[model samples]
Every structure is written in C-alpha cells, then in structure tokens.
Target: MSRFRKLSQSIWHCQYHIVWVPKYRYKVLQGAIAVEVENCIRAFSEQQKCEVIELNVQIDHVHLLVMVPPKVSISDYVGTLKGRTAIRVFNRFRKLKEKPYWGNRFWTRGYCVDTVGLDAEMIQKYVKYQQKKEQVAEQRDLFNR
Candidate 1:
C-alpha cells in the first residue's frame, strides 16, 4: 500500500530507489559486518525522519528504497548515509582499518538514484520518446539548412 506523510504546510509522498557499493566493490559485506551495516542504515534513516521502504544488502552493494521528505536533498541524504555508516562500521571493526583496499574510505564516490512511483513506467516511456523527437528535430534542421 502507498502511504503519504503530512507536514504542517504540505502533504507529500517522495520516494527514491538508491543503490551504492563499497570502495573497490569488495565482498566484505557479510556475516556480522553485514548485520551491523543493516542496523546502521535503519538507525540513520530514522534519525533523518526518512522511512525505509525496502533494503537489500548484497555482498558488494546495497539497494535501498526510501521515502524522504521533499525538504531533504537526495544527494545530501545519500552522503549522510554513506558517511555515517562508514564511520560507525570502521570504528566497530578495527580490522577493516588495516585493509589496504579500504584505505581511508568505505563507500565509493559514485552512487545511482531514481525516483519511484506509480508513473515510473509512464515517465520512462515519455523520456524514451523524447529521443525520437530530438532526432526528428535534427532532421528538420538539416533539411531546412
């Protein structure tokens, strides 16, 4: 079921599907470390007042479906998540600090994000059709020239 949150001035439902991986895509996210990471994510989401719709922690990456308020910037929110989790995990697991690959970073500098909603497919189709329109526009310009 879809849910909407209400604020003093506005009611909204803003959701995003976010995916990110650790530095060097290491398969170290397993066993106790994975559990700790998952817990950290849940705690941080609560602190941000964001709802965790769904979460999947793979050996090398994490997939999260979250509902955040409109006031929150997705990039900033993602940065917070990555930064906090990294610090907590490293502190909790000292051995990780000694790993050459880990160095001084936990997550990579890049991440993938997409808005999620009922009209996602429709939006995708619309964007796909824009390419054809651009092609037609280019052709018309060539003919006119």
Candidate 2:
C-alpha cells in the first residue's frame, strides 16, 4: 500500500494507539509540565525511530497515535519512552520529586495499546454475524437431538 513504511529489508505499516496516565492520574500535566512532557516524548520517540502521528496530553492522561517500525517492540518502546520522559521532566522540574506520590516516578506502571489497522468495524461486524450463525446452528442441533 501507499502508506507502507520501508525498512532495510521489509516494508510494513503498523500503527499503534497508546494511552497512559501520570502517577495517581494527577492534573499536573499542564502549563510548563505539559510542554516539557511533549518535548521529551518527541525527542525520545525520534531516537526510537517512532513517528508521532498524533498526541493529546490531557490533564490526567495522554493519548498518542504513533507509527512504530516493525523492528522495534511496542512494549519496549512505551516503557523506555515513559522512563526517559520521566527522567527528563523530573530533571527539568526538580520540585516535582517533592510532590505527593512522586517517589521518583512520573507515569504509572503500564499503558493501554491498540493496533490501528484497516476496517476494524467491518471485521467486528463479521465476527458478530459469525457468532450468531454458530448459535443458530447449535440450537437447531439441540432440537434435532
């Protein structure tokens, strides 16, 4: 497809929608903190060879849509991204470490990830219809018995 990304040996198109929250889902991600966080994500993602397609830094959570190459694992990328960004943000704003529940951590333990591909709705509908057909077949078999 035209949207495929080329690698040294492969061509693929893999996009991910990731969501993560700060420690305690605090509203601290605003003003200066938000700006620093955005900078960290952008810079770190560039290092990891991930393209930031879209990013929304909410007060309590962050939503990101990114294109990550197949050579990199999504889990590892998210983990390192969180870690590096936390370090940068804390270094920039030393007072953040003194806040409640800081404990030298910026983000929560894990994140939510989903694949972004073609026609998810169509696939979902096809699965639902298949399930209905199976249910009907089972009912007919039970009646026949």
Candidate 3:
C-alpha cells in the first residue's frame, strides 16, 4: 500500500524543468524576436492548461519551469510548446523564413526534462537568473568582439 501511494504521488503534482535548443543553435532571438517568443510562450501555457511558473527564452534555448497535471505527458507537453511557438514565431517574423531560422524546425528534436521536488522558489530564481545571465553573456561577447 505504501508503494502504491508513492507511485500515485509521483503521478500527481509533478514539476518539470524543460530545456530545448534551437536547431543548429542559431542565435535568432534578438531585439523584437525575444518579445515575440515571450508572448508565444505565454500563449502556449494558457492554451495547454499548464502552469508555467517560470520561463526564460535565450538566443538559442528556452528554459521552462512548469507544473504538469496528472493527465499530461511530458513529451507531449514539450512537443506542443515547441511546435506552437515555432509556428507563431515563424508567421510573425518575415526574415525568419529565409534561412537558419525558418528553413527548418525551430527547436531541436530532443529536450531535457528533469523532475523536481518541492522547491518552487529556488526554481523561479534560477529561471529568472538564466535570462539575466544570458543577456550578460551576450553583452560580454559583443564587447570582446
């Protein structure tokens, strides 16, 4: 009975930290593209009926800290998020249609998802910091160049 209970608990109220990269690691998320990606992420969360506690969209990858309901599968959730956002972003950005950005899929085939325990605050801080860290890196790279 205890084992069954543990299994059931695992099925419910699970938190997932997912990361997916852009195809070929293209750094297309610049200027207005980042804002569009943000909006698309919000829309995806709402449409999928999932709770996105934290999300950070970098130039080549996205970090999402989300809670998955018992009925939803992690693979499906990631696929939907990536697919929908790609479509929306491609449609909005004309330049993306040419190459590197829209010539192929927006996201890579595989993603990283980690099951997390109860540490919502820490996860949120990490997600927020990822964005800041990426921005700083970009600035530093530009300065160095």
Candidate with maximal lDDT: 1
Clashes of each: 0, 0, 0
TM-score of each: 0.79, 0.79, 0.80
Clashing pairs in 1: none
lDDT of each: 0.85, 0.82, 0.79
Write the residue-wise lDDT of candidate 3 on 1-145 in tens digits: 3211123456356778888888788888767887888788788777777778788888778889887776778888888888887888788886677875456588788999888776767877998898787778989999999
| TM-score attained by model 3 | 0.80
TM-score head-to-head 1 vs 3, winner: 3
lDDT tens digits by residue: candidate 2, 65-133: 788999999999999989998998899889988877789789999899889788544433443354356
Cα shift from native, residue 4, model 3 (Å): 18
- For model 1, residues 28-110, the per-residue Cα lDDT tens digits are 88898898889999999999899987777777888787889998899989999999999999999999999787877999999
